[model samples]
Target: MRIAIVNPNTTQSMTQAAAASAGSAARSDTVLIEVTASTGVASVESHVDEAWGALSVVTEIERCEASAERPDAYVVACFGDTGVSAAREAAAGPVVGMTEAALMTASLVAHRFAVITMPKRTLRQSEQVVRNLGLEHRCTVLAVDETVAELAEGSLHLLDLFTAEGRLALDAYDAEAIVLGCAGLADLVGPLQAALGVPVIEGVAAAVTIAEGLVAQSLTTSRALTWARSSSPSEAVSA
Candidate 1:
């Protein structure tokens, strides 16, 4: 199966990190197509940022669809699941959002899970995502005082902050598992999991695995209603 992992942010390092994590979780036969946004903010932190990032996500998917090596599935590697709806409309294959995939994966393993995101401002965005997926009852969203740029740098201090937040999720929220809520934090899964001594789910890896499974089952996004593409003017007139 061919899976395209699209990082909505313009940062190449974050895209590399997401691709590496996806590569680790994917089957040997699965081919990964890595793509970074050509235009967008450095990191998607707010509704404004997501608004800009969404365009890049759809553009990349459209570009891939026009290529000879069109992917069998696509993974939107953002905790916010940036441009997922638009990407689904633009791609011929299944599109999996990292946040949705991670939350679903967490629900399967643990009764309750917590999402730890960055920059503090995205807490509401994360919460909205959980609600949108109808997982609000089983999930909690927390924020750490770090930025996506800081996460890309990968420092021990950042690890400590994540560890502290993970413990809080376990203790205060009664969370059974931890979900890292940013694609930039993909590389921290092993370390954070070891520190928390519980399931630490990274969205990129979960999304990639889910995308591969969807392809294996020959399932693509349904274009019957919500994801239906608008017809061109000529096609509309012909109809």
Candidate 2:
């Protein structure tokens, strides 16, 4: 099966890191198609950035669909699950978002989970994502004093910050699991998990496994209602 991992941001390094994380969880027979959005902000941090990122996601999926190696499924590798709905509407395959996949995976392993993301500004957005997914009661969103660019640098000091935050989540919030809230933090899962001694869920890996499962079960996005593609203005007029 072929899976396309779409990094909504234009950052090539982040895309590569996310794809590598996804690759670690994928089956040997599964092929991963990596796509970095051709036009979007350097990193998706704000709502405006998310909007642009989402557009890039739809564009990439449409481009992929027109290619010879159309993927069997797609993973939107943004922690906010940016452009997921648009991607779903544009693709014929199952679309998985990092936030939803990671939160859901965390829920399965532990009853209460806390999401650790960066920049602090996206804390509300992360909270809303959990609420939108109906997991608000089971999850908490925590932020660190760091930006996506800082996280991308993959510094050992950033790992220390994450470890400290994870400890806070576990001790104060009674969180049983910790969810990495950004795709850029994919590579830190092992070290963070080791430091926290609890389940540390990375959305890229979780999403890959979920996408693979969906494909193996022969399940694709349901085009019956909400995700159904609407006719274009011209087509609608003709009809």
Candidate 3:
């Protein structure tokens, strides 16, 4: 199976980081394609960036059109899951957002979860997304006192910083699992899990698993559904 790991950021490093994490767990036959948004925020950290970055989600699908085989799944590798609904609408395969996938997986593992985001401005967005997805009943949003760019800048030591923050989010909040609310932190889940003694879910890894599971079940967004097609054109970017 082929999977597209679309990073909704212009940063190549961030795109590569997401691809690496997802690729590690992908099936041997799964071709994990990595691509960055052609135009958008360098890193998604705030509501403004989330809204703007959401627009660039279709960039990868547009680019992949030239290829002989389209990817079996499209993964929006930002924690906000900016344009997941639209991507699903536009694609023949499944389009899963990292945040949505992580939350779904977290729900299956634990009764409650605390999402650890990068910036304070993102906490509201995270909460809004959880509510929008009907997971607010089981999740709370938390923010790290740092930005995603800061994490990438000192990536060599990110594991330590993330573990410390993830532990605090879990124990302090009494959360059963901690969702990594930034795609850039996908690689730190194992360390964070060890440190917190709870599941630390990352969007990249979560999205891939969800996509594969959907494929296994031969599932895709229904074209006949009113809500899927009745969305306004202005709201349509990709699904």
Candidate 4:
């Protein structure tokens, strides 16, 4: 199966990092295609960025669907799961978002999960994902005074800040799992997991794994009702 990992931001470095993590978790037979948005912000750290990023991501998905060799599934390489619904509507296969992937993965492994992400500005977006999943009671969203760019730069101070906040979340929320709240945080999963002595869920990894599993099971997004097309029958069938 072929999986397209699309970064909503224009940063090729971030796309590379996300692709590396997704590639590591994918099976040998699965082909991974990585793409960075042609037009969007350098990084997505706030609601405004997310709004613009989602548009670019949807365009990328539509571009892929227009390709001669379309991917079997598409994974949005942003922690916020930006443009997931639109991608699904525009594609013939599954569309996976990092945030949803991470949260669902954590929910399966732990009774309670805590998210460690950026400060108040973007915290609500992540929190809403938890609530929308009906896992609000079992999940806690905590913020760090850091940006996606800062984390992606591999700053030790940012790592330290994350680790400190992670520990606090474990104690305060009594969480059994720690979900990294940004795709930029994927590289820190191993060390953070080791340091916290619990399962640390990284969205990119979780999204790829879940995408692979769903593909292997021959499962695509259901177009039954929720994603039912509003267009004509011919257009809907083609979509």
Candidate 1 local lDDT, 86-154, one digit each (tens)? 888888899999999999999999999999988799888788789998999899899897777885765
Query: What C-alpha lDDT does candidate 4 achieve relative to the native structure?
Result: 0.85
**Candidates 3 and 4: which is better by lDDT?**
4
Q: Model 4, which residues run further than 4 Å from truth?
A: 155-157, 230-239
Q: What's the TM-score of every candidate structure? A: 0.94, 0.95, 0.88, 0.93
lDDT of 2: 0.88
Question: What TM-score should be assigned to candidate 1?
Answer: 0.94
Ranking by TM-score: 2, 1, 4, 3
Which regions of candidate 1 fall more than 4 Å away from where they truly are? 231-239
lDDT of 2 by residue, 1-239 (tens): 99999998888888889899899999999999999999879998888988999989988888898898889999999988998887887888899998899988998999999999877998877888899989888888999968888756554558988898899999999999999988878768888888889989999999999999999999988898989975533457999
- The alpha-carbon root-mean-square deviation between model 2 and the true structure, to one decimal in Å, is 1.9
- Backbone clashes for every candidate come to 0, 0, 5, 0
lDDT of each: 0.88, 0.88, 0.79, 0.85
Any residue pairs clashing in model 3, and if so which?
86-238, 86-239, 87-238, 87-239, 88-239
Model 3 TM-score, 2 decimals: 0.88
